[model samples]
Target: MKTLKQLLADKPKTLAVAAPDDSVFQALCVMAEYNVGALLVLQDGKLVGIFSERDYARKQIRNQRSSKETPVRDLMSARVAYVGIDATLEECMSLMTEKRFRHLPVLDDQGQVLGILSIGDLVKETISAQQFLIGELERYITS
Candidate 1:
């Protein structure tokens, strides 16, 4: 089982934030620019919530909350499920699968934000692991 630490070491790029009260449009723009599906919502360097495209449709547009007037803090999913950097990649996969979320922020023990992981990240890792396993199996058979 690969650990979150290993995953982060493998892919050092992370999407992070320190404030959500700034502008919802900014968040959407950043996500679009990065081609990411979610953004970590933070306040005072602490993880507060998560703003995802899923939340956009369900909490805002469907609810008629004006994106231009609303803030990310107002639309974010405050009850975000988080994981530690030392956590297993499998754990992240399980949590996201059960909750149906595409992104998760990795935090330190003090609850400080470290990095964010997405479903795409998990899928990439899973595929890599599978490929390695397959190669090992092939080598074993050849031997």
Candidate 2:
């Protein structure tokens, strides 16, 4: 099983972040610029919560709140689901599915943010691994 460390290594090193005091519009601009669905909410370089499209739609749009006036802390999901760098792909998939989360923040032992993992990333990696395994098995049988 591939670990999150390896998976993260394969992805871009940039981590999208937004300040807790930032307006929801500002966070959404970051998300749009990065083409990401979420941003890790940080305060003084510490993870506090996550702001996603879902959060914006559910908390802001539905409530008729102004994105420019609403702070991310007001709409961000405070109880975030997180994973460690050493965690396996299967573990991440399981957690994401169980929690109905699209993204998970990857953290270190010191509780420092390393990267973020999306469900799409997990599924793509899993499919690629499966393809490699199947190709190997087919070659072995042919030999």
Candidate 3:
């Protein structure tokens, strides 16, 4: 099984983050700039929450809240479900499926944010692994 650490190592080492007190508009701008669907909400380098497009659409826009006026902390998901670097892709997929959320912040032993994972990332990895295994099996069968 591939661990999150391996997946993260293969990805670009960039973390899109926002301060909890930052405006929702600011968080959205950062997300757009990074070309990501979500941003980790950090306070003093610690994971405090997460802000995503879903949060913006559900918590802010639906409620007629102004993104420019509202702080990210106000709409961000505070009860963040995170995973350690050693967590397997299957574990992440299970958790995400059960929770009905897409993003999960990866943490280190000290609870420092290492990176974030999305459902798309896990699915792609899983598909690649399966393809490789199938290729190997075919080669073995033909040998």
Worst 10 residues of 1 by lDDT: 10-19
lDDT of 2 by residue, 40-117 (tens): 999887899999999988778665678898889999999998988888888899999999989999999898999999
For model 3, residues 12-95, the per-residue Cα lDDT tens digits are 897999999999999999999999999999999899999999998888856566888899999999999999888888889999
- Evaluate model 1: give its TM-score: 0.89
Ranking by TM-score: 2, 3, 1
Residue pairs in collision within model 3: none
How many times do residue backbones clash in model 3?
0
Candidate 2: the clashing residue pairs are none
Which is the winner by TM-score between candidate 1 and candidate 2?
Answer: 2
TM-scores, all models, native as reference: 0.89, 0.95, 0.95
Clashes of each: 0, 0, 0
Clash list (residue pairs), candidate 1: none
What is candidate 2's TM-score against the reference?
0.95
How far in Å is the alpha carbon of 13 misplaced in model 2? 1.7
Task: Return whichever of 1 and 2 wins on lDDT.
Answer: 2
Off by more than 4 A, model 3: 62-64
Model 3, position 19: C-alpha lDDT score: 96
